[model samples]
Target: MSGYLMSPRQFSALKTGLFLLCLVPLANLVYGLLSDTLGANPIEALTRGLGDWTLRFLLITLAVTPLRRLSGLNWLLKLRRMLGLFTFFYALLHFASYVWLDQFFDWAAIWKDIVKRPFITVGFASLLLLTPLAATSTNAMIKRLGGRRWQLLHRAVYAIGLFAVLHYWWMVKKDITQPAIYAVLLTLLLGLRVYWMLRRAGAR
Candidate 1:
């Protein structure tokens, strides 16, 4: 294999490792439940934990392109789809926790919360946007959609990321430190992409 690429076996190994690594957060949460270590507000802890992992995976998915460009590691692109799928998986879990555990399947109350709560509104919107992305993540869908259209659809991730940050920020009423950090990191990531676009346009 070239320096910029990985051998097939190595790639398979790395992909498996990453898949398992991504499950660690979920595993830890499960362990906490079994051990009764989630404290007084276990449901809230579980819901927030899944949501945090969802945002983290989303940010990590966004970072793949930058990392690949910076490190000249084209293999990183191979991992991106998997990372994106994981992001959606955790996002689904997060939403499920809220709808089931937190809201107790109360559709009327859920609708009310979504309508009245800014954070819930954005969080729901984020999940709605992620649904199509997750559904069409397959190679077959990409082939059917064609590369250009698929790329356009996937660009919604940027908006999803923005909504996710807003969801986190607005949900926290006190000690906005963590949400503020997420905001700064997301700004830098999106800003880097903007800078690159202008640079390319200037070169052209």
Candidate 2:
């Protein structure tokens, strides 16, 4: 583990690199729109592209702990906050696209869709749940809330992830292949948590 661990300079560089790499997806989306490269349904493409990245980031954030534990790379914990924030960032963009592009700021229709459509409802709820996670992501907030309470609050992420997966699943009613892949990945991530919890309890 020591051999594999990164130096301060190396870690800083890696974090910067990861941060920039994360923005590439949004950059590509912007390029697609500006260059008129996105197909006929550009709005749909943009919205789905943002939503897809949100899910990807969410899964990546959740995997950090397990990866850190397995690989004995404790510095991975430092990256978790950035990854989680990016998850919320993408999710915000996704929700914003749905409200602005898809609904055209038609609050009435948006409200109705949230109420009537299960997928929209789930997606909306996921965003709602993510709001506080993003808000309290700061070190100041962590100190103010206390470590235990902060952990409890952020635990809502598990539900958010499940709802996110369900939202994607229900949205693509016919072709569920992508959603299923996310579901399986999420299941494994969560399964690892459960296994660790049970192992700790047994040790106790």
Candidate 3:
């Protein structure tokens, strides 16, 4: 089916709805942590769970473009920014939890851990890369950067995705099924990007 563009009002409504939808996971995590429902090593569980959702949203946001093109629903573009920002939001929480709860706000120790641990290094890199994208995600910045340049700059999201997947894969000790799934999904997303790029080149 062809996808119609949503009206501004419709888009606003969807944004509000999605904002509430995103809160569910955070709420559950908080409830689980406060009530002591998270089994053995609550902090670790919370960290992993939040990180997982961050990556999940990142992938989901990336998928939106391909899905829109394939399904002929252009309105999907309106949701990508919100999803991407939510991904960053969760990532921030995940990193904060590690810094505050896990490391007791020890900057030196955190830096040491990042240098020493490959997973932390990858995760930290992913966050660092996302920082600028988040910061520049505004209408004025888009205008200032120009469409082509802004798009090129935002391509760092792909690197963020790779780093996120690597971080997860490296963190797992034995049961690698979850990380493997994310890896496969990320591969598909990247593959779609390549295909779309080639398709555009052919059209040009």
Candidate 4:
């Protein structure tokens, strides 16, 4: 795909818009908490809300690659790291809610929950996997790791995405609607990636 540059001013405006847009969820959550409007099960609601946004942001982050390739919007790449970090940020909140509210800092209980509950097991493992990705997201780390190695490490996102969807799918036993939607989105993203890989191999 041919690349066209966006002007610095235009790019700045877009970034600003995305920054605010990303904050909208957190703002809404805070408002809901303060107003006691997050339904009767507030902690569960907050945990679910954060988890939902984490999945959404992960899908959005993964979309940037296909979006840029298809649309020739190279500037979209700039937002990938930010979107990814937001995924981790929300994931942290989801985990924290579980730890503080549900587990109450009970290490033994938490460990038992992680080991005993398959959903929690995968969810906790996914969060642990995400930690290094989030830590190594800096430009400095990329430079230090070298392009090839950094790319290799970041490929974990695909696995993380799958694990995240599985976590959600397992958590929701009855109403599978939300998890089903996320599964479709993830399938599309993974499919696009596979298509591009095959295309590249064909070209070679």
Candidate 5:
């Protein structure tokens, strides 16, 4: 942990604040559900709400390395594990809402949706990619897999992000503006990594 960012107390407080902020959306969902205030389409609202947070957390997790690189706040990396887990958490809720509320756990219909629907296929693939990352995000798993192999497995996160954006884009048939914005943001993030990679290769 770099001593440059803030005192230990302040750092802990920052994490606490971020943790509560992340929970706000889930809390709002619960409140709306209990009050019957999620408009006429509660299932759609719940699913979309969960997807929004999943994307937000994914982007935030991706931002951590760049943030630490630019700002030199090395401790920022510590937050990535929590943020990554939250990404998977919301993703699980998104899939669960679809299966339980939308399809009523009808395996046939769900399988048809996964196979037939482009958006669902992309979303499901992203979830599958994320599962191993979330499951192995422990010190034990790290030691077992070894750092090099663990990093190779986790690199699928970039592909997950791409699949997620594609899933959203394919889902929204009418308005592409929102999806476009996320795509552009993700492209910029990818571009930054590519730029640094080429620079490093050139240096070598």
Candidate 6:
């Protein structure tokens, strides 16, 4: 498959297919919500589900760089932006569910919870970091910020990844298996970044 070379049109079609594939799980969540099939506590289920997808998509988006470098498939970079945006999309839904369904737009209560709950605090911080990345994802912003500065700003995704994993690890009471897996992947991704940075510095 490494030898397989797709034309530009084929590459575009492949990307469309992958994007639709990513949407299936999110669509299932919506279907589940509409049918009232979100387990015992609907709010908890929705929150967990969206949070899970957010982390999953984050991991997927992070994996793109390593995968592209290792596999020599430059096309992977094309999907990263869409995947990152989807991560933010699910995160927004997760936040909305918490504010609307759990806290009912109670600012005071939300503020109190953020201070008291480490998981919530980490999650909120991660979302805050993601906001600017999402906002500046356009070509105009890239041109305005310039490539180097834009790249530096987007590196906040690393911090977002850390906070996300911490949020998951802190939130889970007894079952730590899933969070641990995400932690391992996050570690690998960050480690790769460190390795690349050091290699580039050495080359200089």
lDDT of 6: 0.93
Candidate 5 — number of clashing residue pairs? 0
Residues 131-150, candidate 1: write the lDDT tens digits.
99999999999999999999
Q: Candidate 5, which segments miss by more than 4 Å at Cα?
A: 1-3
Residues 1-204, candidate 4, lDDT per residue (tens digit)? 346477779888888899889989988987998899999998888888888999999999999999998998777888899999999998998899889987789999999989999999999988999999999999999999999999999999999999999999999969999999999999999999999899999999
**For every model shown, what is its TM-score relative to the native structure?**
0.97, 0.97, 0.94, 0.95, 0.95, 0.93
Error of 5 at 151 (Å): 0.7
List the candidate 3 regions with Cα displacement exceeding 4 Å: 5-7
**TM-score leader:** 1
| Candidate-wise lDDT, in order | 0.93, 0.94, 0.92, 0.92, 0.92, 0.93
List pairs with backbone clashes in candidate 2: none
Which candidate leads in lDDT? 2
TM-score of 3: 0.94
Q: Per-residue lDDT of 3-91 in model 6, one digit per residue for the tens?
A: 34888799889989988998888799889989999988988888889999999999999999998988998778878889989999999
Q: Which stretches of candidate 6 lie over 4 Å from their true place?
A: 1-4
Model 2, range 94-160, lDDT digits (tens) per residue? 9889889988999999999999999999999999999999999999999999999999999999999
Q: In candidate 1, which residue ranges exceed 4 Å CA deviation? A: 1-3
Model 2 clashing-pair count: 0
Using TM-score, rank the candidates from best to worst.
1, 2, 4, 5, 3, 6
> What TM-score number comes out for model 6?
0.93
Q: What's the lDDT for candidate 5? A: 0.92
